[model samples]
Target: MASRRIDVRAVSKDPTGQVLRALYAYASPDAGAPCTIEHDGRSIAAREGEPIALSLLGAGVDTLSRSVKFHRPRGPMCLRGNCEGCLVRVDGEPNRMACAAPARDGREVRSQNSFPSAQLDVLRVTDWFFPKQFDHHHLMVRYGTTINEVMQSFARKMAGLGTLPERPAEAPLPEEIDCDALVVGLGPVGLSVALALAGEGLSVCAVEEEPFAGGLVRDSLQWHSRDGERLCGAEASDRDLAKLRAAGVSVRLSASACATFDDGTIVIQSDRALWVRAKARVFTNGCHESVGAFGDNDLPGVYTARAAARALRYGVRVGESVLVCGDEDPALDALSDALSAVGAKVHRLTEGERLLEATGSSSVSGALVGRDERSAHKIKCDAIVASTSRTPAFELAGQAGVEAAQDLDRQCFASWADELGRTQRSDVFVAGSVAHGGRSPVRESAVARSVRDYVTKGRVR
Candidate 1:
């Protein structure tokens, strides 16, 4: 199937009813090679390098997975792996993340935690039967001992991600590496820090959880980076990623740094464990996007604003009629306009307006929104894009002995940092969104310089 073309520079203000929930050719996206994959015994064709979620959704498979307990419908809420909505079994591997895993020819994708099929899961009756909550422990005890045991057994079988892998896989021995500075993310800020440290002749090793190095900045669609890069969206990330490689900075992709020790050792996990001991550690890890409580909040069509926008690069229209809500993120404006460009009616709830409830059975069909209790009204929409305060990813740094406190004004957990990104821990520093300034060029650059200076003064030891 062919796709409709939408350009960021020349987007139309008028909504056109031309999109058909199929692939769209976003302006000059250097698309990957076409490949085929098997989904639940059916064949699907999509770009080779695109994520499994995009490939499956483009093939008209909407219900990706069923909720564990209630069996409510679920789909890709976050194109990134932060949300657990897109979990699926792949090639006999249980609980593989569809949004993070890339598509390959002959790869088998199947929905898990559903009986027979995700589309027609009879298990969803549990949602209706127990409108409040299902107390499995005391559910059948009133009947008898035998009946209670049986109910417990059924509940046990119904829970969990999926069965074990096809076979037990062998574990590899951990690998160890040494570097002058360890940068934990590869977003525009992370890349800038890595490049700056490398320029000072320090050995830098940057680790990114995404399969590719560039971060969500590229996914902003229309918003540009204010990090003094003067580049917008994909251009900023593309150039910085190239620079990181040319400068000989070792970058490990699709890996996460799991732990940090007092002795300056960090453990990273991927296919294999990596023990990295660096003189200084800089965390540029970004924040997490979230949504608020509402009716059928976990429905298949509810997506974080940035998450839905990220899929557009690969031509995945989240929904034809989308209700943009919650935080006023800069990216939401671009998302609203981009959706408008491709035949979607974008309804953005302004200040004082809020989403009261999301309506739909399997996926969102409309939303109830209002500025006050008496002002509520329903807007017909197929998708609901929601966002809240961004919580800085600080668990890894906190494990390294840094402190974090929740910001009431911003409603996020922010790390305490001095002028040079110094945390409570002397050897560990933080930058990027993890720090206070929120993705500022000055913040990232100053922290990188501090790391360079510490190493230059032989303070690393």
Candidate 2:
């Protein structure tokens, strides 16, 4: 069977007359190999290193999974693997995150927790029947023991996620490693700190959960300005990575920090388990994009601004017509402009106008926008790109004995840190959005200096 390819425009000059490329620009053509993966018994062609979720979305396969209780259809909301919307089954492994998994030939992919199929799930009737809530714990409290037993059986069948593996799972042996410094995230701030520490003669290990080290820069459309010249984000990231390698920093991509111990031990998981003991640890895990609460916002066609950018970066077409809503931000502006440049009909709701409801059956067909109750208006669009404030990813910080407090101004939980990135715990440090709220080049530099001082002089200056 021939594979179906998504229609994507080639990289060309942007409206500014400058050449624009997707995530990374290849200098020379080297089409290494093509592979095919089976999705719901249909073969889909995929690139060597492209993510599996991108391949499915590009082929017009949305509504990857359904919610547990309500059976509400879910798709890729955050391409960063921060949400459970993209969970699917791969090669007998249930609930594997599709966005994080790479495409491989001959792999069997299936939608989990959905009866019949994800698109036409029979379990959806439960949503309509319940309407308000389904408290299974006290569902039949007044009934007799016989009725309670029957209800318990039905509830047990309905609850839980994914199918268990038929065969017993084998666990990989854990490997222990020791280093002078361990950086939890490989974003710009984390990279800066890792490079600075490694340059100071410390054995540094930098771990990134993504396939690459660019972080959010990989999905950005704008370029970074240095000395009044524009430099693309991918190019800048590559240059920085080269410098880190030269400074003898061990960079591990696709590795996740699963747990952090009080003794400064970090448990990392990739293909295998790894235990790293470091004298000093720095967290730059960044933040997760929050989705706005609105009617039917959990629909398959609704996506956060960051998720939209990521989809576009991987040549996944969001929609021919897009409706964007939310406050002003550089990322949102860039996404709108890019969509327009690609011939997508872009519609932006005015400031203070909120998304009232999204109307669709299987996927988003249109949306309702209004500033208030009296100003409601309907717009026809296949995709809705919504924006919301970012919440700092401070789970690892909290495990390390760092005190995090809510910042009302930023609307996110921020780790207590000085200007120099020193957290309440002397051994643990925080940088980037984890320490403060948002990204700033000046704050990155200050945090880097503080990390360097702490690593060299045993204290943050």
List per-prediction Cα lDDT, in the order shown. Answer: 0.77, 0.77
The C-alpha local distance difference test score for the whole of candidate 2 amounts to 0.77
Ten contiguous residues with the weakest lDDT in model 1: 17-26
Please give the clash total of every predicted structure, in order: 0, 0
| TM-score of model 1 (CA atoms) | 0.89
Off by over 4 Å in 1: 1-30, 223-232, 263-270, 437-442, 456-461
Tens digits of per-residue lDDT for model 2, 22-81: 433521123325678888777877766666786787677778899999899998888888
Question: How many residue-pair clashes does candidate 2 contain?
Answer: 0
Mind giving the per-residue lDDT tens digits that candidate 1 earns over 45-110?
777878899887776666788888899988888888888888899989988889988899889998
